[model samples]
Structures are given as structure tokens and as C-alpha cells.
Target: MSSSAPWKQLLLNSINSNSHLKHSTYFQLATVRSNGRPSNRTVVFRGFQDGTDKIQINSDSRSCKIEDLKHCPFAEVCWYFTETWEQFRIHGRVDLIDASNSDPYKLEQREAAWFAGSVRSRLQYLGPTPGLPSLDEQPSHDSLDSSAGPVDVFCLLLLDPEQVDYLNLKSNERLAFTTARSVNAYEYIKVK
Candidate 1:
């Protein structure tokens, strides 16, 4: 963080800000099986917390990808920012969030907003059961219409990133940032 230059900041900001937009297509690769076989898929980049150096993703609970994650936590995410020729690669450990102890009423307004934007909530209303129809589903966007939004229920897939790499084609430069959990503290590093 101390070594980041203006160009680095600009690149990071672009990734963090635009990754979650509706149309940005990104791919995340992970070793989903215990045997270490690789699996890749296109996913929506839900959000990230720069302060915490963590990212959020969404996956259907029953998806094969989720099952693959149960056997392996390692994952790599890649996406190119539009027209910039800069590519971002994120290496991280992925996990499913446990909401068993969650207190819905205790969430702050902003937290609630995050929850609502989550794939779980956006695809399926998070009630006791999965895939419940949203009460707010207007007739215009109803299932019968082609303009309907996503309706597949999904679960929260959180990534505790271990490293991030940024490659700029214009400059032919690469920057890597890493962090790890050790002794209940975060160890940060940069590799150029």
C-alpha cells in the first residue's frame, strides 16, 4: 500500500468500482476438488472491501462449483477493465458464509443494503426456504416477461484474498499484492 503509485491507484480503483457492475464479465478459476483439478467459470463480481482486503461472490448452493469449493478453497479471479488493457488477477481462498447465527434485525442500513445486493438476495429472497419469490417483483419484470431479473436462488460465497496481481499491457508492467493471516494478524506484502 505504501508503494502504490498513481497508476496503480487508478487501476485498483477501476477494478474495485467497476467489477460489480451488471455487464462486466469476469472469470474465476479454482481448485474445487481435493485432487487439485482446475475449474473455471464466469461469475459476477459482487463486491470487495479494500480496508479488509476481501471480496464477495455468489454461487448457487447446489451448483457444482460450490461442491468443488467444499473440497478445495483455492481460487483465482481474472478480469480485464474495459478499454484499459489492464488485467486484474486475484488469488484467494473461498468459503461459504454461515448465516445460522446471523441476526437480521441487528444489521445496519448499509449492511442491509449489501445483503440486498448479494446474489442470494438478488437471485432469491433469503427467507427460511430458498428461492422464494420476491414480494417486490413487479408485473413488468415478472417471470412471464423476458425483462425479468435473475430468479435463481444463490448462496453467499466469500473470498478471503491472499494475493492480487495487476498487469498493465500499455506499460507492460505487473504488480502483485499479497496478504496472509498469521497469529491472528494480517501480514501484507508486495511483489514486483
Candidate 2:
């Protein structure tokens, strides 16, 4: 519940230091399925929510990840920076903001995320749901809007970190940044 997550600075530094790599923005998100199984997928990092440490990611409401989150909001984001030889395991709870969401601020974030997306990215959402064969499901060029604005299926996934386990392979150092929820603060513990 801390506004400024202690690990945010380290993550931002890792991102800035390795900005040249395109895959730096990608991370593996692992969620719990309804059947108590773990589902993992690679997702792009949209950015942190405005002025907050919450991680933001664009999602499709129809996506299995959404269903997974509904079953359990908890997830872990695993990010590795090849250039820096560092890895971060962010344990958190995700907040979903879609058309059905009633929160105004979250809805605003969703709208902003939609408009921030490229036309091509926006258009993809109009196609058939993920994992489905799309030959007939494909929308004609003329049938798709270039803007393709935010659809009900387009959702914003925000992750509020509960703990961040950061590892530096080069230095052989590991640290755990855990939230002290009762005090709205974070405790930094060096791990072996």
C-alpha cells in the first residue's frame, strides 16, 4: 500500500540502464488459475500508473489472464535484464480496470492506456479473442477503426507490489523489499 514502492527506483534504474534492449519491457506474469494451477505468460510493461508505483499493463478482458485474476488477484511478475544480469520477482495483487469497472480514476487510466496505444495495437483488439482461430473472425480493413478506441475487452491491469525479490547475479547479491502494510512502508532485507 506504499505510494512509492521501494523497489521502483531499482527497477526504473534497471530499465534506464538497459533501455537499448527491446525485450527489457517484457516480463513473465504468473497467476493462479481457478483450478489451483499456475498460468504464466509474457506481457509487455505499459508503465507505472501516473505518480504511483503500481505497475500497469494492457490486457484484454476476454483473456484467460483476466479470468485468472478474477479467480485470484495475486500474481508474480518475473523480469530479467540480460544486459545487467539482474532479475526481479515482483509479488503483488493486480487491479483490473475495464469498461465494467465503476471507479472513475481507474476508468481514466484505462482510457489513457487505450489512447496511448498505437493504431496497430488498438486494431488487434478488434480481432477475434485471443487463442481463437481468426480466419473468419478477422475484421475487414474497412470495418476496423484506425483509432479503434477502447473496447469493453480492453482492460488496464495494475499491480500493487506486496514484495519485490531483486537479485543481482553479477554481484551475487539478493534483496527482498517487502511491504509493511500496517505502516504503509517497506522493509529492505538482504538475502543470501
Candidate 3:
């Protein structure tokens, strides 16, 4: 947040203004498949990576998005704020942090996300692998371990934005921001 990304303030404002909405934090992430197709899914915002502008997202390692990211490592997040009638199209490369990652800081982030998630939701990661036919009629409630830590399949996604396209429909304003990975400051552009 201390670093200078031109769209940071606008995005923060949008999030703040729309925070009251139940789905305000939901954003659509689009990734290119290895087969050249596009895959998109709505993911919850897990806050930023501390003081950095990179967006934090939690994922299951068994999910297709993980495979898609493994293949391309790039994605675009389309976030809309209905309260303010604003949209931000943020495109960036994602950095994945999983159980295999040895970095201490990244590992801490993964653990933090695990604890941040609701027990009911976290139980899903501990159950049968996704994308398979349901084999059990009733997933045993006794099997859930609320006290357990994040499983090996739990992962963290950090979306480091290189460019942001912002549109404010209410004000009829549009802006674009581009920042090189080499520096914190961005080259700002006015689209209208």
C-alpha cells in the first residue's frame, strides 16, 4: 500500500465504498488454459499481501485454477463495485505459495489464510478431492477437524498487478495504469 500503483487509491476507494455488499469482495479471475482455452471463476478477496499492492487469494491445490496457473501463471481479475458503479480490470502474473514452497514469509501467509477461513469452508479442503462425482451421500461431520491446520492441498495466490484498467460508470471516467515489475511507481494514463 505504501508503494505507488496509480490505481491503488481508486481500487481501495471502490472496495471501501462497496464493503457493505455481501458479494462486494467477489472478483472474477480469468486464466488461460494449457489447451489455449480460457477459464474463469469468482473468488473471494483475501486482502492484500501486507503493505504490497498484490492481491491475496486462497485456493485448493487440486482445483483446475491451480493447474491453469501452473501452466500460465498469469491472470486478469475483473472486480466490480455496484455501490459506486465502478469496475477495475487488473491483469497480472500470479505467484503461488503452497506446501512445497520453502519461503518463510510465503508459508506464513498460507497459514494465516487457513486460519482466516471459516471452519465450515475450510472443511471442504479436508474432504474428498474436487471435480469428482460425489461418492458419499453425507460427508461425515465428525470427520471435520476444526482444530487442524491447513492441509497440503491448501495454497495461496498472490496477484501482482502490472496493469489496471479502471472505469467509473457513474462519473463517466476511465483510467489506465501501467507499472513495470522493476519499480514500485507506475506510469499513469487517462483514458478520457
Candidate 4:
């Protein structure tokens, strides 16, 4: 275990650096399942808001992890830097971004880009629409044409980080610091 001061400085420095987070692809998201067991999965961090500490994660709200959040709001996220051997642990409360909870303009813009990427990632790689059915497979219901255009059902996971833990594998030490909204104002504590 190590003192929190140095780790907090490292955290602030890393988060502020564009290159540190820019190319990072995956983060570990941990949520308590309905059965009260801990469940974790790898998810991509779309972006994080600077002043608010709000992070946006692109995920299907219908996912098991999302459902777990609905049952239990607490979540823990971990990100490891393979090159630098530094790891960041984030403890936060997770919430689903519904129409009422999210900003319309921001959500819509991100959603449009998300839908486009979703379609391109899945359909474009497959070449063309196969002989199964066109986008509007069900005329009675809304069009299933995700390839044709964007949809609104998709949502972004909002993370309100409360505490952060930092670990330097090279130094063989760990430090824990918390935010104001957490129990204390960034106290340096050793975790053994």
C-alpha cells in the first residue's frame, strides 16, 4: 500500500492528458447482479466530461450489466495501462440515461454517431443486406432499419464517480483517494 497524495496527482495528470485516454479501448465495468453477486464485463468508455466527472459509456440499456445497475446503483470500474503498468479504479453510482434524465441535445448528437457506428460495425462489414428481409421486416411495427437510419432506444450510461484508486504495478503500490461527493475530500489511504 502507498500514500494517496502521489497517486492522486498521477490520476489527475493521467486524466488530463489527451493521449493517456484517447486510444484506450476497453474498461472493466463491475455491477452487482440481481442475485446480489458481483458481475463484471469489459465496456468501452466513449468519453468523460471534464468538470463534472461524468463518463459516457456506449451500451445497450437492455444489457445484463445495465439491468444490474437498475437493481443496484453502485458500480466499480477499472482501467489498466498495459504500457505504463498503471491502473485506475473508479467507484461510482450508475444510472441509465432516460429521456427525462439526460440532455436532449447532447444525447441526440451522441446517439446519432453511436447508431452510425453501430450500423457500420455490424452491417457494413457483412457487405450488404442479405436475403433474410429488408430493414422494415415488420411493417406493422416501427422500422427495424438501423442500417437505414438511427434509432432512439439506444442509451448512454452515466457514471457519477465518487472515489478513485490508483495502482502502479511497477512500484508495487496502491493508493485510494475519494472525491468530495464521496465520504471525504480526497483522503490519502493505504490499501493492503
The per-model lDDT (C-alpha) reads 0.55, 0.84, 0.84, 0.61
Instruction: Give one clash count per candidate, in the order shown.
Output: 0, 0, 1, 0
Candidate 3 local accuracy as lDDT?
0.84
Writing each residue's lDDT as its tens digit, candidate 2 over 40-81 gives 988888899888888988887888889999999999999999
Off by over 4 Å in 1: 1-11, 16-22, 49-51, 98-115, 118-153, 183-192
After superposition, candidate 4 runs with Cα above 4 Å error: 1-23, 99-150, 182-185, 188-192
Per-model TM-score, in order, reads 0.62, 0.90, 0.90, 0.65
Q: What TM-score does prediction 3 earn?
A: 0.90
Candidate 2 least-lDDT 10 residues? 131-140
lDDT tens digits, residue span 114-136, model 1 = 45452434534333444332322
**In candidate 1, how many Å is residue 144 off?**
13
Candidate 4 at residue 26, lDDT?
64
Worst 10 residues of 1 by lDDT: 134-143
Q: lDDT per residue, candidate 3, 1-192, as tens digits? A: 356476888888888989999789888999999897999988888888877889998888999999999999999999988889999999999999999998998899889988887776676676677522111223447465667888898889999999899999988999998986566468888979
Candidate numbers sorted by lDDT from highest down:
3, 2, 4, 1
Deviation in Å, model 1, residue 78 alpha carbon: 1.2
Candidates 1 and 2 compared: the better one by lDDT is 2
Predictions: Cα RMSD each: 7.1, 3.9, 3.7, 8.4
Number of clashes in model 4?
0
